[model samples]
Target: MLSNILLITAVGLGSFRSVQSQSTPSICDNSTLLIDSRQVLTTAQECTAVAGDIVIQYASDYPATIEFPNLESIDGSFLSINFDEDIRVTRLSAPKLKSVTADVYISRWVNLTTINMPVLTTINRVRLNNLPSLTSANFLSTLESIENNYEVTNTSLKEITNDKLPFAVFVEIFDNKELEKFELKGLKNASYNVALRRNKPGVEVSLPALKEVFYFEFQRISSLEIPELERVIGHFVVNDSTVESLEAPKLQNVGLWYDPSISITNNRGLVIQNSGDSESLSFPVLEAVQLDLVIRNNSALRDISFPMLRRVTGNIGLEGTFESVRLPELDRVGGIFSLGNDEAGFNCGDLQAFKTNGTIRGEFSCPRYQELPTRSSSIGESEKEIKDWLNWASPSTGFESFRSMGAVAFAIGISTILLVL
Candidate 1:
C-alpha cells in the first residue's frame, strides 16, 4: 500500500510539473501601441485563427494598451476586438473564443486612456499583477467585460468602484483583499442577481436599483443605502458596522415576507427610518411575516407603526423607542407581540378604536373607552332583540332557546312591545 501511494504521489507531482513547464510567465513591456480593448494578440495550441501573411506572435511582456490590427482570436478563445476609435465596438462578438482559459494582459500602451472591451461575456480569470498605474477597470463597459463567472485577485486595486458596469452576474473578488470600496453606479440599469460578500474596508455598499437580494452580508460597512429595494429573496445580514437606519420604499419581506418562519438577528445597531416625509408606508399584500423585529438598541427611534399590518409570525420588539407607541390601524398579529420597556412607560391606550383582530397580549391594562353615538330606547330595544335572536341561533342549547324567545317577542311587538327581556 505504501509503494502504491508513493507511485500515485510521484505521478501527481510529475503532472503538475508538466503543466507548470508549459505555462508561460507574463512579462511587462512599456513601448507598444496599446489596443483600445486591452487584449494581447497571441497564438498557442489553443490558437484557432493565425495571421495569414504577417505571422506576429504575442509574448508575455506585451504592453497593457497594445492593440492588434488584424488578429482575429486569441488561442481559439472567445475574442472581441475594437478596430475603430469611436469609443464603441464597431463589431463585438465572440464565436470562436468559447471560454477564457488564461489571463491576458496589456503591457503598456501609454496613449490608451480607457479600454472599451464590452464584447466579452465570460473570462475564466483575469490578472492585474503589474498594473501599478491603472486607476480603473474602465475596459469593463456594459456587460461585455464581465465573465459569466469572474474572479479578480492579487492586485494593487484601490476600487472596484464602477458606477456603470452593466454585467448583471456573480463575481468573487477574493485574494485582492486590499480592495476597499465598490461602487454600483453603473449597475443602476442592470438587474444583478448576485451575492457580494466578504470584502475588506472602504468597500462602499450602495444598491439603489436592487429589487431582489439573496444572502447579502454587509459586515464591514459604515453605511448601507439600498433605497429602491423591495424584496429580499434570502438571508440578509448587516453586522459589526455603524449603521444607523435601514429604509426601503416598497420592501416587504426580508426573506419571503409571507413565510413567517425567518428571523432577523445579531443586528444590534440597525435602525429603521421612514423614507418619505411623514407619508405613511404601505404594505398592501404583506400577509404573514416571521422574524425577530429587534428594534431595541436603536435609542433614536420615535415611532413603530404598521397601519395595515396583517400578521407577525415572530417576536416584535418595540423596546427602546421614545414616548408613544402607535399602530392605529393594525389588523392582526399571529404570534407573541410585545412592547419592550419604553422610557415613556407604555402610555398606549389611544389606538383602541383601530384594533380589528388578534389577541392583545402585553400590559394591556389601559383601555381608553370612547363614547359611541346614543340611540333612542325603542331602537335600542329593537337592536337588543335582533342581537339576542342572532346569539340564540348559535350552537348552544340555552342560547338557542333564548333566540326562540327573542323571535316570538319580535313578532308580538312589531310596534310598541318595547322588547326588554
Candidate 2:
C-alpha cells in the first residue's frame, strides 16, 4: 500500500512540527495566552492564575492601557477579538479579574474605550460585540452568576444595570445605538431566553425582580416593566413597542411544552378605551395559551380581555380595532378561533357559543375575521396547512414518515445487487 502511505505521511509532518513549536506559552502555563508579540504583551503581565485561554490578537506596537495587574482566575476564555486591523487597546484593565470559567469575548473592538473589570463575579458567557468605542463597562456591576449567554451587541453602552445578577439562561440586547436604559434588578429567574431588538428608540426596560421565564421577547420599548412576572415556559412576545401600557401584574401562563406561539405585534398605543388604556390589553391574571395566540397590528387596541382565560392549545388570533371581546373563562380552543374586530358594538355572541358548544376544536371565525394562519416555515405538504401545526412545529414532510424508512432502504439496495450475482 505505497509503503503504508509513506509511513503515514511521515507521521503527519511530525505532528505539524510539534504543534508549530508550542505556540509560545509560558507565563502561568496551562497554555493559550497568545497575545501576539511585543514579547507576548510583556509576558502577559506576569499571569496570576490563568489555566488557559487569553487571546488578544493583532499587535504591532501594543499599549495604551492593557493592565492586568496580577490577573486573577480564568480557567478559559478572555478573548479580545480583532478581525484583521483595528485593535489599538484603549483600555482593558482587569482590576483583579474575579472569575471567567469560560467566555468574556469582546469582539471587533474598534478602539475599545474602557472595560476595567472591577471585580468580575461569575461567568460562563458574556459576548460584547462590535464595540464602537465601548463606553465604559464597569463589570456590569459585579455579576453574580451566568451559566450561559449574556450578549450585548453593537455597543455604545448608555445604561445596563444588574443589581447583582440572580439568574438567567440567555439575554440578548441588540444593535445598541446608544442603548437608553436597562434594569435586571436582581433577576429572579430566566430559565431560557430573553430578547430585545434594534435598540435606541425610546428604550427603558425593567425586570423588577422577574419571577419566571423560558422565553420573552420585547422590541422597541419606551417603558416595559415586568413587576414580578409569574410564568412562561415558552413564548411571550411584545413587538414593535411604543409601550403605551401592558401590565403583567403576576401573569399566570402562556404556552408551556410543545406547540407554542404568541406574538403581540405593532403596538401602537396598546389598548385604549378608558383612561388607563383600558387596562392596556391587560392580563390581570391570565390563565393559559399553550399554542398560537397572535394579536396583530395594534392601533390603540380598542378593548379585549382574557379575564382568567381558560386554555388554548393552538390558534386564537385577534386583529385590531376592538370594542369589547372578553373570553369569560374560555374553556378550550385547540385550534383556529380568529377574531378580526372593526369595533362598533362588536359582538360575536359569546364567540358563537364557542362554535355551537364543543369548545371550538377547530376552525371558527368571529364577526368576519380572516387571515389567521401562518406557521411552519417549510417542510412538505405545505406544512399541513398550518392549523394545528405540530410535528415538533414542522419537519416530517409526510408520506407516512418516509414510507417505512424508504422501504427498508430500498430493500437493502436490492439485496446488495443480488449478492453480487
Candidate 3:
C-alpha cells in the first residue's frame, strides 16, 4: 500500500515537470514568430494570435497536422518555407482564417499534399511556387479579392477555379505540367496582363465574361474560348500552339490609341470558320489599327476579311499563301501596303487607286515586281516646266475651257487633252 501511494505521487510529479518544461510566455506580444526546425512545437495553441509576421519553416521533425482554429487575422505576412526533404506535414488547416493583410508565400514544401483554409477571403498578394507534391488546395472558395499579383508556377496543381477574385493587376500561370483545366468564369477585368504559357497540352481555358484586358498572350494552349471579351488595350498575341479554333466574337480593338499591333502566327491547325455561315478568319467589327498589323506564317489560313475596317495608321503586312483576301471597305492606309505571296491572282488595282489618291504614304510591294512601274513620261522635263504646266491647267482654267465648247466637242477635246498630258 505504501509503494502504490509513492508510485502515484511520482507519476503526478513527472506530469507536472513535463508541463513546466514545455511552457513559455505567450509569443503574441512579439511582432514575429519564427518556428524553426530546432524547436519542437508541441501544440499550435502556444502562438494563437500573431500581431505581425508568422514564419513556419525548416521543421526537421515536423508534425503531421498543424491547425490554427483561432487565428482570425494576420496583420503581416505568413510565409512558409519547408525545405526538409523528409518532413511529413500532410495537412495544414486554419478553419477561421478570414484575412491576410499582406502577402502569403507558400513555397518549396516538397512533401506537403494539401492546404485547407476554408473561409479565407482577402489577401494582398499570393505566390505559390515549387511545390511538386502538392495536389489540392481547398477552403478558398470564399476568397474574393487579391489586390496585387497572383502567380502559381512549377506546382502539381491540376486545376484552379476562383470566381470571386474578379480583379487583379497581373495573373500568370505557367510551367504547371499537370494542369489540365483553368476556369475563371466570373473574372470581368484585368488591369495589366494575363499570361498563360507552357502548360500541359489539351488543357482547356474558359473565361466566359471577361470583357477587357491590357495585354493577353497565350503560348502553347490547346483551345481558347473568351466569348465576351470586347477589348484589349495593348497587344493580343497567340503563338506556338495547335489551337484548332479561337473565338473572341466581341473583341473590337487591339491596342490603345497610341500603340496598336496584332499578331496571330504559327498556329498551323487553327481554323476560324463559322458553323452555319461562310465567314472564315473574319474580324467583323475591327475598325482601326493605330500601328502595325501583321498576319503571317499561318499555313492553314485560307481566307481573311475585314469588312468594317476604315483606317490603318501604320503598315499592313500580309504574307503566306492565303486563298482569298478581302478588305472591301478599307478607306485609308497611312503606311506601306506589302504583300508577299507566291500565288499570283491578287489584283493591284485597288492598291493603285489608294496610291493615286495619296492614301498610302509608303511603297507597295508584291511577288511579281521588284518595284512598281513609274509614270509613262519618256522625254525628260525640267522641274520648272512641270510646275508651270500644273499652274496653267488649274481648275478655273479647265472649267472655263469646258464651258466654251459644245458637249460632244468638249468630250472629245477633254479626251485628247488627257492623252496629250
Candidate 4:
C-alpha cells in the first residue's frame, strides 16, 4: 500500500512538469503572445497581429526593419501583419519570395533577388523609382496592368507577352532593342492602340487582331501574314526580306487616309506578281502617293498588272526587264511615263493602245525589226530659208489663177505698147 501511493505522487508531478514545458512560448512566436523587453521565449512560430493588436515598446530597444540577408526562400503558409496603427510591415524582407499570396505593395524594396510574382497577377499599382538595384521580374501568366499607359522599360527582357492582358487604352513596347519575338495571341478581340518599334534583328511578329500599327519592320523575316489587319494609322514598311507574295484581302485601311499610297522599296526577292486573269485585282485603296511607284531591281519580274487601278495620281515608272504592264482602267496620271533599261521582251502593246493623257517617249521595237528612227527637227540654213520664203508667199499662193493671171498681165502690157507704136 505504501509503494502504490508513492508511485501515484511521482507520476502526478511528472505530468505537471510536461504541461509547463510545452506551454512556454519561444522568442519567434508572435501569435497572441506578449513579451517584455527583457523577457525571452522558446517557440519558433511567427506572429499574427490582429486589428486591435498591441505591442510593448521599450526605451532602448528598437523595432524590426525588414532586412533579409541570409533568407533562401519564404515558404511559410502564414499570415503576417503590423501591430501599430501606421502598420509598418518593414521587418519582413526575403531574398527569394517565391509562391507568395496576397497583393503585396512595397516601396524601396531593394534586396529582392527576383520578383517571381505569379501570385500578384493583377497589379493595381507599382512604384520602383527608388529600387535601383532590382534586376529581373517573372510576370504572371495573366498579368494585366502596371497602371495606365505603363510598361516595364529599361531592362533586359527577351520576350514579353501577358497572355491575360489584352485590353487597355494604350500600350507601348518601344526601345527594347534586344527583344526578338513577340506574339500577342491573347489579343484576338482587343480594341486597343498598340505600338511596337525598334525591336532586335530576326524577329517575326504576329498580331492578327491589329487595327492600327504605327510602324512594323519585317526587315529580316521570311514570311508575314496578318489576315485580319484593318487599319494602319502610320507607316508600314517591309524592307530587306525574301517575302515572295503578299495577299491581304481584309486589309481595308492603311494610312491616315484609307489605303494611302505606300512605298515598298529595296526588296530584291519580293515579287508582287499577280497571276490571275481577273478583271480587277483588289489592293488597298489609297488617296495619294507621296513618292514614285518604285518598282526597281526586281529581275525575276515579268508582268505588272492592276485591273482595278481606277486612277494613278502619281508617277508610275516600270524600269526593269518586265515583259508587259496591263492596267485596264488606269486614268489621270499625275506625272510622266518612264520605262528604262529593258533590253528585250518589251510588250507594252496594251499600254500603247490606250491614248495616254501624258506624253510617250520610248522607241518600241521588236527582235526582227530595228527601232524606227526618231524624226529630228531640222534647223539648217537651207531648211530655214525654205521655211521663211514659204511663210512670206503662202497667203498669195492661195489665190485662184494667180500664176496664170500674172503671166497674162505681162503679155498684155507688151502687146499694148507694140500696138501703139
The candidate that wins on lDDT is 2
- lDDT per model vs. reference: 0.37, 0.67, 0.60, 0.36
Mind giving the per-residue lDDT tens digits that candidate 2 earns over 1-421?
9999999999999988777545333565756777876777777777777888888878767787778788888899988776454556778898999998999998886887889998899989899998877888988768899888888999899998889898878889999898889888998887787888888877889998888877778777677789788776666777777777777767677644432232322211112122222225567576666546666666766555656666655667776664555666665665677777665555566566676666666788876677655444343322243233332222111010012112211000000000000
lDDT of 1 by residue, 155-241 (tens): 445566544454444444443445666556544322223433444543556766666544344544545666765554443444444
Off by over 4 Å in 3: 1-25, 38-48, 64-66, 82-87, 139-141, 257-282, 332-335, 343-356, 367-421
Instruction: Identify the superior model by lDDT, candidate 2 or candidate 3.
Output: 2
Q: After superposition, how far is residue 180 of candidate 2 from its true place, in Å?
A: 11
Clashes of each: 28, 0, 1, 9
Residue pair clashes in candidate 3: 118-139
Q: Model 3 — TM-score against the truth?
A: 0.70
Decoy 1 TM-score against native: 0.44
Candidate 1 Cα misplacement greater than 4 A, ranges: 1-157, 163-180, 186-203, 257-290, 319-321, 342-344, 348-421
